[model samples]
Every structure is written in structure tokens, then in C-alpha cells.
Target: MNHGPDDLSSTGEFDSDELALRRMLQQAVQEMEPRDGTLDHLRKAVPARRARKRQAVVGMAAAALFFGTAIPAVVHVSSTGTSANTSNAGHASQTQGGAGQGKEEEGGESTSGGSAGKPEDKGKGESKDADKGKSAGASTGASSGTDPSTSTAASAAVCTAVQLGTPTATTAVPDASGTVYGTFHITNGSTAACTVSGPGIVTPAAQGAADASKISALRHVSGDVASAGLPDPSQEVAQLLLQPGSSYDVKFAWVPTETCPTSEPSTDPSPDPTTSPDASSSEGSSTGGDTGTSTQLLTEDGTTDGSVLVTNTAEGGGPSVSTTVSNACAGVVYWTGLLTSS
Candidate 1:
């Protein structure tokens, strides 16, 4: 009873008691044993329980997502259905009102007819209705602002030679291809507007005064060499309308022959030997003492060669317009359809 606390902690009795408690706890733990397959069952059951909990969580989340989307879709469908029903109701009401108004009009017309029993009165009413119909038709036409038939007839009036002014032409210098570009301007000098239906007949004038063999062959073509700057013939209107003072153009190109024909030498006898001795001797020696045997090449100026005369006659018989297209040699002449001038 008088011993101190440190001296008690070193006593053999307290140490032996602690050792006994430890031994008993060890023995209890060693002696304990579960039933057969308890560990395996615990292992399987624990995982199965955790899996169930996970499945429950996933199911709850999926249900929440489904409801979240489904509620808005349901609401939208309901609103659309309501709007459609309202529109249908409104259209139905309008249709019913129109039908009722028609019925009322028919009733009023019947009542008025009953009041006016005379056959003459009925005929007068019909006449008035006819006049009203005519007036209505006229008002409709005025409202539309144009008559197709009248416009068509006005535009269809073809131009005659008397209505056309004197045609003028301008020719450009020949290109490397020997193609000369020119435009024949035809003016509508008449006061009234007229249409040119198509490209009129183009023909080479009868070889008058010029060599017949050297006349350029006239050919109607859409386009040809050096025609790039000219208007496209294919795009021309079928009926070209020309107002007063307005002019149209007919583009043409002249292609000269590749080679020119040589002219026969003059038939005049060699210079008289009795004339001046210097001139007679020079001319006689130059002529090789032959008369009319020398050949001379034709010049490309068309003055000595030959000129092409192009004549354009409007379709349906109109006074023809002619132009002298100078060509160095014989070749084809290309002409295009009527084109609106700039």
C-alpha cells in the first residue's frame, strides 16, 4: 500500500496479467472459423450488392434523362396541336361565313326578282347585267394597262423599202486574211415604227462593166474572219423593231482570192521603129519582139483587177440597196443577219 506508481508498473504480477490477456485474444482469433464457403459467398455477395447499387444509380439517371427530354417534347406537341386546331377552326369559320354571305346574296336576288315580276323588267335587268359585264371587262383591261393583241399587231408591222432611208456603208482596211470588215447601215426614216423580219436577201450585183469572172461569190454567213468586234448574228431578234431615226446594221466581210489572175498583154504593135530611135529600140527590145505575147499581173488595188458589187434586197419585195466592195481578187463574201446598231 505504501509502494510508488513506478514501482508498481515494474511488478511481475501486472506484467503476467497483460501477457495472459494478449494470449487469450490470440487464441480466440486462432480458434474462430466461418462456415463452408463463407469467404467465397461474402466475396460474391459483396460484388453483387455493389453491382445492384450501380445499376440502380444508372437506371435513376436514365429515367431522369428520359423524363427531361420527354416532358419538353410533349409540351411542344401539345402546343402545335393546339395551334393547328385553332387554324383549322379559323379556316372553317371563314368558309362558313363565305357560304352564308353567298346564301344571303342569293336570297336577296330571289326576293328582288319576285318583286319585279314583269318579263320586260327581267329582260331590262339582263341587259343592265350585260352592260355591267362589258364595263367590268373594260375596267379589267384598263387595270392591266396593256392589250396583248394590240401590242402584237403593232410590233408585227414590217418595214417597207419606202420607210427605209438611203443605206450607207463603211469599210475597214483589209486584214491579214484579206478579209475586209464593213457595215451597211439601214435607217428607219419613216415616222412610224416598223420591224425588220429577218436578214434580207443578199446577192452580188450582175457583173456590170467589171469582169464577170472576177466577181466575188456572195454567201450568207453568221460570222467570219475579222467579225469579232461585230454583234453576234445568232443573238439578233427574229423581228427587229426600229423606231424612227433609229438605224440597224448588216455586217459583212469580204475574203479575197488567194491568187489573182494575170491580164493579157496589150495588142498594140511594138513602137514603130521609125519613131524616135531611142524609144523604138527600148520598147522593141523590152517586148522581146513579140506582140501581145507578154502577160501582166493584176494589181491588188481592185482598180485594175475587179470590184465586187453587193446588193441587199429586203424580204417580201423592197427596194434594194447596193454597195461597191472593192476586192483585189475573186473570193467569198460573208454577210450576217440584221443587227441593232450601237
Candidate 2:
């Protein structure tokens, strides 16, 4: 069992020489001393080194997280923009297509048939344009049709003598100037409508003491002092369409002059003395006194002295209507145009 040093080495046991060498290393380690300040330097260097390592790790993680979120966000934004552009393009195409369809319907042509230079297409286009023009013209004509109707109503046939009712006359109290103002009322007796134009012919009645020469001196005026307190005839219409049973007024002024003749006494023989006194007095009163000439008298009833006659001759001829416009002195007559009744 006792082996040599070579036998002990093969058996993994330390010999006397190895034991002595280990003892020498231990002795050297026990006697060794660090340089001054070496511990403090190591203490500070260790924590700083650890902090640098941690900062490097955190920086790497943050860079990774930022890149991860940023790349996807960029991709999403790019995709969204692309989608919006595509949608806008689609909508634009649809709008254009609809417009094309409308044009096709109106012009009776297809968008695919781009042969605009063909004779048949040109003819169709011209025909459509002509139809549009015709429609516009028809609309315009329909809108303008009201004026003719109004003009027709205004231009009714002239009233005839048979269609007119018997005209009546009225006279107002004479003014201080012996100017008599009155009105002539003309009516439409027939059922039909008719027109009366202009101030009709006016003449004095033959029954009164109206002088023919004086009556012939009638004048037409817009207005005069004799027409005061009455409606102004200047503003009245010259012509009027009268419906059945309707009436119109014509104002007249009888202005007297100083040339009228005075009354003259009758030359008849005096009544017999045997006649009763009352009868004689009546007869004498009936005849004017044989004395100086007296001024002509005009009464309200027109039987006293003078008279006037009015005839509507607008239709060539009509019945003569007479009104009492007795003027004491010889004067001119003024008549007015047609005036609507109040």
C-alpha cells in the first residue's frame, strides 16, 4: 500500500513538494497590502459603472418602444389618406356619369357614341334645339295673351240709338253770372255692352224761347267758372264702355252774354169792358205791359224762357235729348266729355 511520489500523483494526492509550494503562496497572500485610496476608488467606480449600464438598458428599451408605435402610426395615416383619395375619385366619377346621363336623355344621344360630327347626330341636335325654342315661344305667348282681351273689352261696339235709353237732363240754380250748370244722363237700355265716345251734340229745344243762333254757339271746354261746385270734366274719360243698365254723365255749362233781347208787349186788342174785372186783369197779366223793355227771365222749369237739346251723334246719329238750360242773356254753351256716375 506504500507508494512512491509518482504513485501518489497518479492517485490524485499532494506530495511533500506540492504541500511546501502551497504553503509558500499562502504566506505571500497573507503579507500582501493594497495601494493608498484603492478601496475608495473601487467603491465609487462600481456604482457609477452600474448606473451607466442601467441607463444604456433604459435607452435601448425606449428607442424600441418609440419605433414600434411610430412605424404603425405612419402606416395607418398613409393608408387612411389613400382610402380618402380613392373615395373622392369614385364620387367624382359617379357625378360625371350622372351628368352624362342627363345630357344623353335631353339630347337623345348616348355618351358612348362619340361621333358628334355625323350628319344624323347634327340633325337630332338641331331638332332638339328647335323644340326647346318652340316651347319657350309658347310659354311667352301664353303669358302675353291677357293684353288683347283687355283691349277688346275697352273697344266694345259703339252704342246705337236703339240700344240707348231715353236720356234725361237736369239743371242747377244759375250763378250770379247767369251761368247755368247741368248734366245729361245717358243710359244703356239694351242687355248688351256698348261704348259711348266724345261729348255728343247739344242743341236747344224748339219749344222754349231759345234763339237758334245763340244755341248754335256751343263750345267744348275742360272747365269754366260756370262749372264750379261740380266734378271737373277735364279729368273724365273721353270714351266709356257701358254695361247693360249702366249710365254716364255729361256736364254742361250755359254761360250767358249781354246780347239777349228783352221781352216785348203783345199788340193784341184789350179784352171787352163787359168782360169780368178778374178776367180782364188775367188777360192783361198774361200779356206784358206796354212799357219799357224788361230783362229776359229764366225759370228753373225751363218753361219760362230758354232751353237746350243734346244729341249723341257719336255713332253718326242718335235721338236728340232736350234739357232746360234757360239763359236770360244770349250766351255760349259748354259741354264736357263722358264722366262715370258716382
Candidate 3:
């Protein structure tokens, strides 16, 4: 039984074969170890691979940007050319429709897609022209509606003297110098329009005169007359035409208590009233018949009577109107005599 369990008939021979197998395994393990530069080569290869991937990604982005820019540019250019051709075609169609044939002669396509859009463009153009014409007509109508000269003439027509009422005198409180201002207002009372012009006449009616002839004789050549004032009635002024119920105003002034200044002889040779024949005769007659009766009129309160008669002359051969104003004396207006006018 012991021979059966450890029965190595050639035990020394098997031992030599085991030593050879162990030597072969040791040599194979040493051959299988990594080389010195293997990890360094792997690190270098990883960076190279990452750099290539980045380059590929950058190239793809650049291509996308190029295509994005180029596509819209191409579309814009194509659309611009199409619009130009369409406009030309429209113009030609309106005239003779021969531009397409000419373009075809120049190596251009006659059946282009832009040809279909020409009808719509022409419709738009016609609508625009119609709108322009409408606008022009509206502007012309607006201008014609309000003509300046016609409006001015219509507004300037005024009432004449034939339509006016008699001038009425109004007296205000006297000033410090015993001077009173008399304002005469003339109103247009008739239905007819009229114009009043000129420096009207004012005659002071002598109060308590025995006869009208004596009152006329009291009026002297050097008395109240028409004179230019603020508006300078002497200048060519536009006629003030008044409508119905319109009115105009004129001013008359006086100083009832003021005395005439005493006359003094000057260095210049002047005629003496006492030596004159007419003055001597007038003084002798006044002393004989009219001794107590004063030549110059005086009011009841001993002040000089300042009564006046105003006459308004009409324009263009129209009838004149007269008014009698009581208590209006002569006044200085702009270094001349102040009469009646507006």
C-alpha cells in the first residue's frame, strides 16, 4: 500500500523537469513588466487627442457662422435684383411691355419668379398715385376756400354818413384849468351801410344873439376849424364804414373861463387895429347902438358861452348831417385848430 501512494518510479527525472518549468515561468514574468517611457508616451498622446477635438469643434463653429452670414447676404442680393427687374418690367408694361424681350436678348430669363410679383407692385403704385392726386386736390380746395384779398374787401366795407345819427355832445367834469372836454358820438342808426370821412366843420353859435345874422357875423375867419390830431385826418385815411348799430366818436374841447392873451407890439412892423378904418367904424357902431349888449357871447353864469354847431360831410355826393352842440369852445389841437372828426 505504501508503494501505491508514493510510487515514483523515476523521481529524480521528474525533479529535473520541475526545475526547468520554474526557470521558464520566472523569465516570462520579467518579460511581461512595463517599459520606462510607456507612461510618458501615454500622457503626451492624451493632450494631442484633446487638441484635435478642440480644432474640430472650432472648425464646425466657423463653418456655421460663415453659412449663417452668407445665406442672408445671398438672399438680400437676389431680392434686390428681383425688385429692380420688377420695377423695370412694370414701367415697360405701362409703356409697351417690351422690356422682357430686351432682357431676354441680353441673356436674362423672361419667365423669372419675380415676373409674377410685378402685377401686385403695379397695383400698389397705382394706389399711391391716386392718393397723391387726392391729397393735391384737398390742398387746392383749402387754399381756394379762404382768399385773403376777398376776405379783406368784404370786412372793410363800412357804413356811410347817410346811415348815421346826429352827433350828440357829452361833457365831463372840468379840469384844473377850467378846461372841459366835449366828446361827440355819432351812431349808425339806419339799415343802409355808410362811410364817414373828412375833418368836419364846427361853428360856435353865439348865445343871446338878437338875430341869426348877428350870430353868423360873430364867427371869424380865425376861429374853430378842422385840424389834424392823433390819427391825422389830413392824411389819406381809409374810410371808416359803419354797419347798422355801429358808432364813431369825435372830440371837441373848450376852456369857458379862460381869457384871451393881451396882444403886445412886436419888433416886426404890424398894423394897429385903432388906426384901421374898418376897426374904427366897427368900434364907433358898437359904442352907439350896442352899448350894453356884449359882442362876445357870455353864458348866464358870466362865463363865455361855448356853444357850437357841427356838420359832418358825406363821401361820394351823399347827404350831410348837422348837429348843434351847446357849450363847446375853441381848443388847441396839435398846434392847430381842433374841429370834429374821428
Candidate 4:
């Protein structure tokens, strides 16, 4: 049935030229690269991306709804359930019981609302304070400021009159200027050490009432006791440290002179006592005039009838003590200095 190419074309059948072109096209398509699974991957990825976006939108809406509605509901439940309400006593009790048990399971802390929780709250507060105390005690050494234990130890180490003993006096010969010098010795009789201060008084010895004496010295008292602390700008006082069975001396100097220094009289007018209340109140009051009395070495009555009183500076008030000495010289000027040990 082999027919010519022109006759097949005229009979409206497949031409030779069209057949060759189809064969060439098929061969070219087969030689090209094939894409495996690319379309399938794209088809899978588009729907997955759309699903994730939709899920995100749904999650945002759910979160907004929970915050706007469910959160307030939970808050109302927590507040109404845990707190007191006079209208609903039974409900409050039940809620309180549940809250207490729940709190115990959480951290052993009962809400401070009803009487049932008060005891637990008190015990927990006490436990917390005890823990704080232990931590504070552990860090005490590193803390700044005053500590009670340190202050107590320091006070215990300070010396006082409880350890001081009786003082004895001895006289020496008069110098070329007729000034009398003497030494008084104080011994520590206690089992511990002590501190003693001086510039103490020295006057004529006495017993009960003052009476005339035959001694040829003036009745004069020395200045105040030399302080064991910093007192003034011009003078420095050092206290005597007396150990057990130890002693220290205080030197005394007396000048038998006649002249005495006096304060000049003030020219201001005196105040009137008639305008005041009573006479007894005006006894020691100065009237803005020259009312200061003169100080003399000799007593007015010329008697040595007073008792000696020795006052010691100490806490808790120690033992009672006295020193007796007589000075009968007339018109004598006396001066005392800081205490010293030689």
C-alpha cells in the first residue's frame, strides 16, 4: 500500500513533512531535564502557609478574649472566694477552707482573713523573725555602729572606786621660801586594777562640830579633783593606774603668803528685793551688784571641827572613805596641779 507523498497529501492524509516534524519534536523533549516533585512540593507548601496564618489569627483572638473576659472572671473568683462577705457566711467559710488548704500545698502560707489563719500567720511571723535574728547575729561582726556586747566589755574594763584603798599623807621640811611640800600615797587593795584622780582637797582635820586648834597652819582646801578625761584647753590630766598592791603619790604645795587676789567691785546699781516674792528665796540671789564674798585661807571661826569626805567617781557607788589632815598656817595661798606618780 505504498503510495506517493503528493497523492497522500491530496487525499487529505498525514503528509511526510508533518510526520518528520512531529518526530523531531518528540526527540527534543526527551533530551531536556525533568523536574521531579517540584510541583508537588509547591502544592503542599501553599496550603500549609495559609493554615499557619489562619491558626495565628485564631490564637490572637483567643488571647484577646481570655484577657478581656476570663481574666476578670478569675480575679473575681480569687477575691470573692478568699475575702470576707457578710451576706454569704457559709460560702466564705468554704472558700476560706479551700484557700487555706491550697496555700498550704503551695507554700504553707495561710491567707490572713479569718480567725483560723491567725495562728498560722503568727507562727510563721515568729519563724521568720527567728531566721532574721540568726542571720543578723551571724553578720554582727561586719555590721557598723554601736554593739551592746562590745560596750559592756568596755565598761567592765574601766577602773572605779571599788578597787581603791585608803590614802596616807607624810610631810617634808619647809623650803627656803617657807613653802610646805607634802606627799600623799594611795594604795590599791582590791583584787583588780583601778584608776585614781587628784587635785583633791587638803584642810584642817575635824571630827564633829568645829573647834579651835593649836596648829600653826591655815584652814585651806585645795582645788577640784583632777579629771581623768580631757577637760580644758590649757591643762591635761592623766589618771593614776594602781594595780593590785601598788600605790601612787599626789604632791601638795602650800605657800604661806599674806596677800590675796580680789575681783574688782562692779559699779552697777543693786537690784531691789522688795519687788520679789519672799525673803527666803532671796537668800543666795545676787542683786546685780558686788555681792561675791571674799575667799580666805583661814576659817571665820578659826576652828577645825568638820569631818573629811572623800568622794570617788565610780559606777554603782563604791565604798565610803575619808582622809583627815590639819593646816593651821594663816593667810596661806594654796594651788594644786594634775596627779602624777614618781
Candidate 3, residue 266: lDDT = 33
Off by over 4 Å in 4: 1-162, 197-199, 203-236, 258-327, 333-335
- lDDT tens string, model 3, 10-63? 454346566667667867896686889999999999999999999999999999
Worst 10 residues of 4 by lDDT: 147-156
Better of 1 and 4 by lDDT: 1
TM-scores of all candidate predictions against the true structure: 0.44, 0.44, 0.33, 0.27
lDDT of 1: 0.64
lDDT of 4 by residue, 251-292 (tens): 444443422223344476765766466664555354444845
Writing each residue's lDDT as its tens digit, candidate 2 over 1-342 gives 777556767877897789668668878897789999999999999999999999999999999999999999999999999999988875565454454344453556543334323434577788999999999987555433322222223446888888876887787887776777777787778877777775577654432455666554445544555456456655677576677777777777777664344445547887688989997655535435675334345444433464555443433377456666544435666766667765
User: Which pairs of residues have clashing backbones in candidate 2?
Assistant: 203-309, 204-308
Of 2 and 3, which scores higher on lDDT? 2
Ranking by TM-score: 1, 2, 3, 4
- Tell me the spans in candidate 1 whose CA falls farther than 4 Å from its real position: 1-156, 206-230, 264-267, 270-304
Cα lDDT, all candidates: 0.64, 0.64, 0.49, 0.48
